[model samples]
Structures are given as structure tokens and as C-alpha cells.
Target: MANFASTADLEEKKITFEEIAENVYAYTAEGDPNSGVIVGDDGVLVMDAQATPIQAQKLIDCIRGVTDKPIKYVVLSHYHAVRVMGASAYGAEAIIASQLTYDNVVERGQQDFDSEVGRFPRLFDQVETVPGLTWPTITFEKKMSLWMGKREVQLLHLGRSHTKGDIVAWIPDCKVCFAGDMVEYGATPYTGDAYLSDWPTTLDNLMALGAEKMIPGRGEALKTADEVKAGVGGTRDFLSDLFETVKKCVADGKDLTATYKETMDIMRPKYGQWVIFDHCMPFDVTRAYQEASGQEHPQIWTADRDREMWLALERDQSAA
Candidate 1:
């Protein structure tokens, strides 16, 4: 009963950005989603591979332009296919992530890959180039630290925001955090599988890092502290306002259909232009509606469910 938007309208590919911060570098594209790169004396580490092997290799090409060091590690912030499916292209000795992420990868990685490939066909340009499901070689519980020769990268499971297994890569010396989908710049946060109640506190923990700059999950790299705050604040605000609106409707004993209609009216004006603003709302509201009604964890989205939800939401939205 969530009013969703279709992906049929988006069409274009743009160059990605690479921000050089002393030794660490952030490779961000125009919201095909962003990834990070850190160069150490002996090797290199990449955060979140692109959607397909071909796309990831493009990032590797960009990396080679900056440094010749081998990519020794690839870190996955979560189990989302767009972020992790490109791991094979790195040829790194190890891939690292949180235990929850690893488990989610094991539980739903294939399904996610199929669903995402269908959702964003343009992003996964060379599906055959994908070597298969990208699994993490090393997994951790709460926190993990890596020292690539002299540079230290701390991967912390700050708390669930975008997903239950979300992690952020912290480069202490540079005071920069590569916050994967946990934050986005000028883009709508996808709350389809989110923990809305916990997302803000997770943002609170991220702010405490005092990061001077940040590379969010998508869009441009945040250069100023205010930009960082804006990115996180925007997502938090959208989710908070959305949850409250949905909750009020539910409290009024409205059905899913009525609540979806009411929620859409409340969010469109303030957040209608963020990238994929329309495409992400249905899933966002669907999960928000469930969470507001006491569903602690979001249900996994299957291809059938994706279509069903899309059609149902589209029908309602079109009628209005």
C-alpha cells in the first residue's frame, strides 16, 4: 500500500569524483553511489566496490592514476549488492566487514544481487563481469582495526541506520569517515530495509567522530563540516518526519492505503528533488509504515514483492 515511484525515467551516467586527503582518497561519482580509497605505504584499501565488476574496474583505473600500490583490502559497509558485488574486480587478498554484514551476505546476497541488477540495470553494465557473489574473507563483531603498513583504518559498526549491519571506515589521522549508505549527499535515503528509530542515534555517534570531512554513500564528497551535518541531518530529518507522520496516521487507525496517501502528501514538497526521491519513497514508506506499527526489523524485498509493491503504490499514486 506504499505509494512508490518507478525507475523508468532515470537515464544518464556521469564521472565520479576523487577527493585527496593527505594519504586517504575518496572516489565519488555523481550518485551511481560513492566509494572510498585509502593509500598506505605498502598497499591500498577500497571501501564499497561499485555495482558491477566493469564499474569497479573503472574505479581501479582511477586508483592506478593516483597510486601504484596494490589493492590489499576491500571493506564492505553492508551487504547491499550495489556496494559489494564489485569486489571481484579488486583482486584484494582480503575483504573485511562486520559479522552481521557477513551473515546477511550469506543469507541474502544472491537475492539482493538479482533484485538490484533488475532495479538498476544501467549501473550493472557488465553483469557477466561479476565473478559471482562477493563474500568477505574476514568478519568482525563490533569493531575491527587494520594497519596497512603504517596507515590505520578502523572499521566500526556504529549501530544500525541504513541497515542492521552498517559500518563506517574511520581514518583517524585525517579525521574522515567513509560512511557508506549510513549517510548520503543530496540524495534521498533509502529506508526500505532501515531501522528508522536507531538511525538518528547512529548519526549522533558519527558526529562525535568530529570528522572534518566525509564521503557519504552517494553524490559528492562532503568537504565542510556543515556539508557533512547537512547530509546526515537531511536523511535523519526525512526519516523522522516520515515516521512521525506515518505514526500519526496509524494511531488514527488508518489502513496502509490511507496512511501511504497521507505520508506522501507530507513528504513530497520538502524532499521531492533528492536523487531517486520518487523511486525510494514507496519502499521507505512501506518500511516506515511497518516499523511504526511495531515491526522491529524490515522484511527482505524479493523481486515479486518489489513488483507487487511498485504496482500497488503506483496505482494509488496515479489515481491521486
Candidate 2:
């Protein structure tokens, strides 16, 4: 039997603060959820708050290490509990997210919080400090542009990849972008809340921005154009491969358990070394199965549903 995620990920990873562009930083911790920091002329814009308030403080420390600018904006790339809950620690002037993202929080934020903690307990080091669901003080529809003094940061919806509320911040002058969970370099993109059919097109829209440097949701920052293209392509391929496999399973009238096994067998060899492959594949396959089965909107995943699925799929199939 495979070790549960709890057992497999006990030790913490070393966090690195690397500057991908001038005053643009990527806070990556070995394949853990990442946060982006941009120090503009007047203030700072932080993309994706860490999992908890305590986890967020480490980011604050990194921001202070280089620039003393106050964090004026906090961007929510999506409505995931692990990404948005750390807004409090930033003490930013405003929290920004897509209108859909804010709606998602209103609809299923609490359920996601409970479910995610149960899956990756170590990521929420100080879960207690999270002050309930994080809300966006500002929201936009398709696209919105803001200025941190003279620098321009365009927040675009670009259809949907990871989630309905997914947004990516583009720094046109720097030719760098902060892609929330839209892109992953050496990490597996979690798709429990994804739109599988629309994801590839959304990725194309991301590439359309022509960002030479990019910060993936997880994994180290992509420093070159080739590296950036590879990250986007890798994410697109992973999603396509997983969804196609699930679609075939559904066509063959296979059950979720059988489908999951086949998916693991197919994806493991190519993405086995990628971070969170085992933990994410189960959730990814579940969502892909639903999409392939004709569900337009993803079903809300509560803590109870998370466990039921894990036991049904991740546990001993022989017993099942």
C-alpha cells in the first residue's frame, strides 16, 4: 500500500527568495505552494498569500529584507484556501481577486479549507492563525489594470485554467508574469477545481502575454523564455494527458477506482518525481472524470467528500 500524504510529507522544505526581475521575487519552498512579491515604486504587490498567517510572515520577512515598501495590494490568483488565507499577514491596503473568485469563497471556501488541511496538514503550519475565509476588497470581471506608482500590473482572467476565478498578473514593462496556479514548472498542477476542456486554451492566452520570465504557482521561477515556455507546455501536457486518460476510461465504462489506477500507471512514469504527484493525481483524476462525464461546473468538495474519495481510491483497492 502507498503511504498516505500525511506520512509521505512530514519534513518541511527550505524556502528560497529569488529575484526573477528587478524587485520581483519568487517565494518557492521546494514544491510547496508559492507566493510572488513585486516591489513597485511606491509600494509592493504580493501575489497569492501563503497558507496561514504564520506561513505568510515568512514572506513578509523576505519582502522587508529587500524593500521597506508597504504591501499595497494582495492578489488572489484563485480562491484556494492555501493561497488566499494569508492576506491578513500582508497588511496590504487592498485584497484583489476576480469576481468569480470572491463568489467561490462565498460558495465553497469553508469546505475547501477543511478538505485541504486534511490532505496536507504540514502546509498549514499554523492553521489556527488563519482568520476565516479571505475576502477580496476589490474584484474585476475579465481584466483590470492597476499601478503600483509608475509600474503597471495588468490582472487578466484569460478564460479559466486552474479554476473559474483564476487570474494572472502581468508586468508588461518587466516582461515577467505572476501565474497563480496556471503554470507549474517541475510540479504537478492540482486540478480538483479545474476546467479541463478550457485549460489548454487558457494556457495559450497566458503564453500570448509573451512573458520572458514567469513565476509558476509552484516550483522554482522560470528565468528564460525557453524555460517559461517549457513550464507552460509541461502544465498543458499534464492536464491534457490526465484528462485524455480519464476520458478513455469513462468511455470504456470503467469505475473511478479502476480509472484512477490506470491514470497513476500512465502519469507516474512521466510525472512521478514532480512534487505532489501522488497527492494531487487522485484529486485531479476525480475532477477530470467529472468533466469528461459532462459536469459543467465542478462539484464542491467538502472535507467529508475528500476522505470518502481518498479511501475509495488511494487506500487498498483489494479491500475496496
Candidate 3:
């Protein structure tokens, strides 16, 4: 009834390609999913491919303006379709991700692809260009490091937060981190497939990296230590508050619909201005509710589930 999820969000956002460090760049749209670029001596590595090959080409165009190096690697921070489906467009030598991420792809990749496309139609502009699931050519367990000539890019799966397989790409030389959905600046996190209880601790681990600059999953790149701290802190606060509120509602033996209402009443005033706040709340609260009720792993979100959940929690709300 509320136009479903992000279906009414049709306005295009202005894209920004800014260099946050010497060779590290952030490709961000106003509040859409952001991508990271690291230009190395011999080649380049891209973090978090956009939703489709056409969307990926826009990022490639921006990269071409800065360097002519071959896009040698594509790194997926997690298994979300929005972050990995466009990987084929890079034509990279290898696509890297955590082993858990690969497992997720094998398990529910198609369901997620269908689910996300239905939610955010604008982001998946050319969905037809995506070639099935984007499987990783290389998978790591905990951490791995790649030497881009003289620069060292370390990929670390700090902990489970945004998703079980979320990883951050750290550039030791520049102290810059490409933190995929694990951290967000002025954007409400989409935690439909998250481990809400483990998220805060993961944020703590992410902060311990001491990154002076960070490129978050969505929103602007954090260019200073203070900005980085704020971004991480903001994300932590949102997740903690939402999860805790949901936990309390569950402890009181409230139903999912009532729990959703109570959580919204508490969170909206504080996080109302964040991008996608409205769209994310229903899914975020539902997942939090499940976790608080003792569900360990997130259930896969198919298109039908998305609609059912929306109808249950958000049918009475104004259209997006």
C-alpha cells in the first residue's frame, strides 16, 4: 500500500567521485549505495560493484577519468545483490569475497536478487544486464592482503554486523577503510539480513582499525578521523537502539505488529532525517524482532516475504 519498498523513490541523485586519500576514491550518490576505488601502480581494485552492469559502467567511467589502469580486481564486501551483481561489468581478473559470502551466494543469491530489485527499482536500472549471480573467484576465511604495487590493501572480516560476511578493505598506507554496509553516514542501515545482536561488537572491531578516513556503504565518504568516528558511532547507535527496543517489546510479549509500532514511535523522532529511514524501518524492525525472539540466522528475504512483511507492518503508512 505504501508503494512497497522504495518503488516510489524515482528521483535520481547527484553522483560524486571524490578522492579521499592519495589513490583511494569514493563513488557516492546522494544516499545510494556507495563504491570505493583504489588506484594502484599496475592496476586498480573496485569495492562493491553497483546494482547492474550499466550502473557499474557509470563507476567505470569515473575511474577512467582518473586512471587508465586495468580494473584488475573486484571485491565484494558482502553477499547482497546490490553490492555484487554488477561485478561482471568490471571484467576484472578476479572477484574476491569472504568464504561465508560465497556460501550465501550459493544459498540464496537468486532470492535476494529478486527481493532487492523489487524494493529498489531505480537502483537496478538495467537489471537485465546482470548475468545471474556474481560468484567470487577467490574467497578468504578471516583476512587477506593484496599488494597493489607498493600499497597494501587488507581485507578483513571483523565480525558479523550488517551481514555475516561483511568485510572492510583497509589501506594501511592511507589509513582509509572501505567499510561496506557495516557503517553508514546519515543513512538508515538496511538490516533485513543482519545479525542485530552482534552488530555493536562488530562496530567496535571496525573502530579498532583506527582508520582516519572511511567510505561507508551508503552516504558521503568520511574524510577525517572525527568524521569516521561519527559515522561509526551513528551506525552503532541506530542498530543498538533498534535492536534493544525490539528486544524489550519481545520481552513484554508483544506481537510483531505491535512491536513494530512501538519501535517506530521511539526511533522515528531521532533517526527520521536519515536517508531511507522510512523504507528501512519495516525490514530492520522485523529482523530485529526475529533475532530478539531467538532466531539465530536471518531467514532469506524473497519478494513475497518482502510484500507480506510490508503489508503487515506498513500498510497504514503514507506512500513512499
Candidate 4:
């Protein structure tokens, strides 16, 4: 956690908000770094709860300040610990996720819980407050629909993007989407287990939704149609650039350390300052390198793997 770029040495939490469209909102922290809220007729649906119970309550408090509706559901965009471990705070009747995400939860939730908690210590200040691994009471395959009073909620799995079971909450009526890690506004997309080759296509499918407003996994909410497109395009651009550069180096028979160093040097002028750029480069390069070597799916990332990769990259950086 000491060298993890998420905190960049920060010791406290920061939160902010933006009104994306008519009834949609994004609660972003700097960035603690999950949780978005959508208000409907009956109550509210909390997307991606914070890592700990206390962090989750902060979001719930914000909801109370805005409306009195009961939180009817807690939606797990995926099984990442930072995004779903705070479920108990909502006391939601149903926790929902895709079948794939559920499988991921069952496969490695404990490891992720420990891993993320370690990487983002400040974000998980009240680690003991976590109720345990968060599980979706209801799981779906492709898509599902719901109503909050009169507003329509459509949850669709476009395809693999950030994770194997990545899903987006689309409000068709308002053309707003809560894209969890599938897109990031002015931030580096985390691709620890991402299907890099397929992510662009998944993004293309998101474009087909004609979303006018969007809440990316991190950064500020995109309020204009143009801005929304920019966010998606930004992620695609980064992914494409990453793979293309890494592929060339990989093909040139460069070692992992050398290839990662060269790729980062190439990407820096264009994207070095983007949020989480430093933190993501190690994992991103690792995945890109593997894919270039013909690994179809990305290998799973655990806390131990995170450290090993980080130390390897850091040593190379220092030597350079």
C-alpha cells in the first residue's frame, strides 16, 4: 500500500457530486473511489458501494440529504472489493449482479477483498466495518429491468470490458448510463483481468446505446452527449495505444521490464498525467504483454501479484 499510486500519499477521503441528467447523479470521491446513486420513484438504487461500512454510510447520508426514499436495491457493477464491500450500509433488500460477476465473487472475492483493502488503506479506513464479502442475492445472465416509481431501469451486459461480467445500468428514457469501469473520465481504466481485444467492441456497443449522459467508473460525470463519447473514446484510445505499443515491443522480443519501460515512455507525453496512470501502467503493461504473446484472456491479479509487478516496474524505473 505504501507505493500504491491511488493515494499518492493522501491520508484522508474526498467526495464530490455532479448531476448527469434529469434524475441521475454521480457521487465521486478523489477517488475513494466507487459508489454512484440513481434516484427513482419508489426509492434509490446505490451502485458500487465503498469498501467499508463507514464509507458506505457516507454515501447513504448523502442520499438522505437529497431524498427520503428507501434504498430498494444495491447493485454491484462487478465483484471488485472497493466497489461492493460496503453493501451492509444500505440494508438493501436485494443485491444484484450478473452471473459472471457472481462467479468471480465466488472464485476470488476474498483475495480481492484483502488485496484492495491493502492497496487502498485510506479508502478502507474502517476496514473492520466491512460486513464481509458482498454477495448478490439476485443474479442475471444478459439483461434485467426494473422500475423506480415511473422511471425505467435497464441493466445490460454489453460484453467483457473491465471485467468478465462487466455490466452497465442504462436509463433509456434519459439516455444516461452508469458504466462501471467500462469507461473512465479523465482517468486510467483498470484492466487487471480485462479482455483488451474485446473491450473496444464492448465500448462500441455502449455507443449504440446513444447515451447522452454517463457516469464513468471514476472522475466526473459526463453530462453532454459529446462529453460522454469523449470519455468512452478516451478509454478506447488508451487501450488501443497501450496494446499497440506493447505489442510492437513484445514482437521486438523486448523483455517485460524493458517493454513496460519503453511503453510508459511512449505513453507519458499523451497520458502520463491521467488519474491512476502510474498505478495502472504496471498491470496494463503486464496484460498487454501477455496478450501480445497470444494469451487470450488476462490472468487474474491478486494482492501478491500486484506487489510483484509493482516492485519489478519500480526497480526498472529507478535504474532508468
For every model shown, what is its TM-score relative to the native structure?
0.95, 0.97, 0.98, 0.95
User: Backbone collision count in every prediction?
Assistant: 2, 0, 0, 1
Cα lDDT tens digits, model 1, 192-255, are: 8899999999999999998889999987888888888888888788888889998898899997
The residue-by-residue lDDT of candidate 4 on 236-267, one tens digit each, is: 99999998998899889999999988988899
Alpha carbon lDDT of each predicted model: 0.85, 0.90, 0.92, 0.85
Off by over 4 Å in 2: 1-7, 316-320
State the displacement of the C-alpha of residue 229, model 1, in Å, after optimal TM-score superposition.
Answer: 1.7
Give the runs in model 3 whose Cα sits over 4 Å from its true position: 316-320
Greater TM-score among 2 and 4 belongs to 2
Task: For model 1, state the Cα shift of residue 201 in Å.
Answer: 0.9
The residue ranges of model 1 lying beyond 4 angstroms of the native Cα positions read 1-6
Candidate 1: clashing residue pairs, number: 2
Cα RMSD, each candidate: 2.0, 1.5, 1.6, 1.6
Residue-level lDDT of model 3, residues 246-295, one tens digit each, is: 99999999998888888989999999999999899999998998999999
Number of colliding residue pairs in model 4 = 1
Tell me the deviation in Å of residue 282 in model 3: 0.7
Residue 149 in model 3: shift from native, Å? 0.2
Give the Å error, residue 69, model 4: 1.5
The digit string of per-residue lDDT tens for model 2 on 1-320 reads 34446546988899999998888899999988899988889899999998899889989999999999889999999999888888998888999999999999999999999988877778787798887889899999999999877888999999978999899999999999999899998999999999999999999999999999998999999999999999999999999899999999999999888999889999999999998887888889999999999998899999888888887786645564
The lDDT-based order of candidates, best leading, equals 3, 2, 1, 4
Residue range with the least summed lDDT across 10 consecutive positions in model 3: 311-320
